[model samples]
Target: MPGERKAETMEEVDLLVCGAGAGGMTAALVAALEGLNVVLAEKTAQVGGTTSTSGGTTWVPGTHLSEQAGVPDKVEDARAFLESVVANRGGARLREAFLASGRAAIEELDRKTDVKFVAAAAHPDYLDGPGAAYGGRALGPVMFDGKLLGREDFDRVRPPRREFMGLGGMMVGRNELGALLSPFASLANLRSTLGIVGGYVLDRVSYKRGTRLLMGNALVARLLYSLRKAKVPVLFESGVRELMIEDGRVVGAVLEGPTGTRRIRARKGVVLATGGICWNRKIRERLFPAGTRDYALGPQTNTGDGADVAMAVGARFDDGGDSPALWMPCSSYTRPDGSLAVWPHIILDRAKPGLFAVDAKGKRFVNEANSYHDFAMGQIATGAIPAHLVCDAAFMRRYGMGMILPGAGNLAAMLKAGYVIEAKTLAELAGRLGCDAKVLAETVEAYNRSASTGVDEAFGRGSSVVNRFNGDAEAGGSNPCLGPVGAGPYYAMAVRPADLASSAGLAGDEFGRVLNEEGEPIAGLYACGNDLASIFRGTYPGPGTTIGPAMVFGWRVAKHAAGKLTDQPETVSGVMTDERTKNATL
Candidate 1:
């Protein structure tokens, strides 16, 4: 039932956005652009949520950037792919709404704000299922010059976690990867490397963080830049303690900030973009699989605040699939500063030849070149609580494991730190890993044979053209993804299934309206980003699946509030205990 939203006793804005990630910021921006009074609040002192620590890739299917990148994508093709991959866990309508609005979201941000993006030349859908594009669909925010944010603004922007950044604070994007990997490969590489290093050196002279913002950090900076242009004050250290509902309609929230507690009212509604429930221990223990760990390299502030608030006000949870969260294999070690250096094995290591995950039996159980999410899922299926990511001496020296960059970082220091386990032979490595030596040797031989050829008969490693996106082209042996770990010295790292993002979230309608357990909207409450139930349920479809929907639905929520709702599918996301059941999109 729609109740009177006017709250005379509280400070009010036309729109109140909670969580300042890409989604929340987008909603605020849209409202501000439309001349609506909007206020943004973040739980942490920082603006960006998990998005600041991510690659900021959004899985928007059709866009001008895709055309510019020369990848032809059709809505039907993407729809087909989603149907095959999502498998009805989240229903068809929600996916359709996402597909329809995704491109428009990017376009609006590009046209109305400083947010700009470019399609990856070769990103692929995680699953080699139907409607997958080799590229042109996944888009990353174009790198932003931190100087444009100015020193004060740069200082305000949250820095990427130290372990995620290079040179302590410098951010490197896709454009700089090749140069950083092989500085002597070309004059361009040399020059680019020098430029980055020089800039970092100068930046360290005054700024506490690197001025070169890239990837997700860059994306957040861009959004913040736009917000600054709009003159929106994003209140930090302000966490929502409770949602105030009158006659079943969410009308306001009691916020706890540094100064004091205040009830803030929203005329339009509140946008919840709190990045997932990755760090919620109680939820993870109760709902997720046994032995599931929080080795997340994402924002630790994700305590399910948004979901909790909404659920307290009647929103339902969606955690009824084979898995309850998006998976990532993470490696972590404590730093001398008492902070943990956690590394998410999303990319930069896995697909780069000579790496394989093995169980205590020392046998390979999965395709080495598969996406991190799928690889982690496969690990969980095998019940391998601690899988070993093994590689040879040459491979380790050439391509380092998590938090241990190749051809750089102190390798011996890392080994001594137990960040990596080292041995002179497979037998010794197997002994260290408590796996059978003979079986490990045979597994290596079988894998090496496949590496000698271009085919992995056992698992078809690198069979998909998309696998090469995270692989190395310089060493395109029989397969660029395959390399014999037949060398004398070996290295291994213990990896576990880490929660990357939550697939289960609060249910919502097409207008970003929060839905109750009975499948009806809770008027004046909306959710975007990881706060809302994932459209694909627990399956990770492609790069930026999290951010893409977040931005689009955030846009949808704002438009709906502003009376500017356009062509949007009527149905949205909600609880579905069974994937086979239709109307999975509530």
Candidate 2:
């Protein structure tokens, strides 16, 4: 036993962060900035985790960026908004900690790290409630030049999902999407599209993927760049197998990687941010609702390693939330390479004009324009296990559905692949979907009546701000989310419930320290990102909710470890006053 232990290489650092996501990278970067020797371990060869593939919206309300964008917000307002919406599903203290530190976290990152964020001009809150802002609350990462990271580091950054990209590996943003989707719409659009495509073409000459990175790719690249700048050692393809305990305190961890097993001692603390339990089938079965499928949008490597090691100790899971996971309706099809590609139906076609979803019996179920989470919830509540998103041929050509691109000429290929069903008549479409022709025809007739009047009497399709914001205002007559599905042939794409990430995870204190079953902090054990229980308690309040809290708490964890934060209340670098520090322990 002694010889085996001796054979393992031992290393020491002030802080050891397990995970290479936004939260974990933030921890390592901050700790290193605070003059602490830090090491970051990523289970996979690539960094970024799911963040690289995400929209990279960080919802941190009441920041300087908001004021700069002329959409000023207040922390108190955000608190009131959360209190009204979130209620008592999660700890009030944790929410307060996030609220108090969010501005400071973003400000600190902007001032010290390569990470930069620009507030969205018009991104609305997913839910309408007291103290919610129209915009400025959500910030998107500034574009990053992937070439600046060099070929080796650039290659280390995880690529965005194939479904979200263009060409082979070009990352596209929402701003350029309109131009690229309709390049000849205007002179400006044509120029913009050309510039974007030209940039990608130039990028391909020297890079494996697009050099001009946006959204999650930009966020991950900035964090990765900052970590490298701070000289933090990143252990790629290394995972924490067990947390080494010394007198009831987490002192180190035994990690397994490509080379061999190694032990790293953390003098201050260790932070867990290894995505979550979304891919852990055993835990997924236990926590998720019955009949939920085994599919997650996150990388498959997120198999609960962080929770497993923490739970192996005295740490307990936080199972108190509206749901165990964040939901997204996904559809899958095999790619030309013979690999399966799962496409998340998130805020693209569902809320657009000329589309509607129906249950197995051909009855309209939910407000198709509702948020993805609420849409999935509607499916579960109404027994619409495999809901069908129906649209006319005109809609398919204009908006597309699931993985089908707008105005795409590959309809025949998709139909042949069974990703989409096409038919010349509503009755024929119903036959393919296994629904009664009479019921299907009647449902369409009723929906058409509502579309003509621009009033969805059944589901209130475009009544909300978010609904209209995501809808095609130029296309729909009165209600942007309402349009006639009359033009034939008809098409259908079935979507099933899939989680973008896990909300239920290890319980932790406001300081991001992992809590034991007795409701006390486990010494030197901290968590952030999906590894920690969601502060909002499974509520999808707004854009970037997950990433916002993740970075804030990660900042808290690092500051606490570096001895810069304490139990005594104090001002935090001019970002928070004494009043704001009441709930947070400095």
The TM-score that candidate 1 achieves is 0.93
Report the lDDT of model 1 for residue 304. Answer: 85
Clashing pairs in 1: 57-544
Q: Summarize candidate 1's per-residue lDDT along 375-478 as a digit string, tens digits.
A: 88888888877788988878877888887777736788888788889899888998999989999999999988888887889988888866776778789686
TM-score of each: 0.93, 0.95
Write down the RMSD of candidate 1 (Cα, Å): 4.3
Please report, in order, the local distance difference test score of every candidate based on alpha carbons. Answer: 0.80, 0.87
Per residue, candidate 2 scores C-alpha lDDT tens digits across 288-385 of: 77557577888989898999999988898987498888888888888778988888888989998789899999999999898888899888788898
Tell how far residue 123 is off in model 2, in angstroms.
0.5
Compared with the true structure, the alpha-carbon lDDT of candidate 1 equals: 0.80
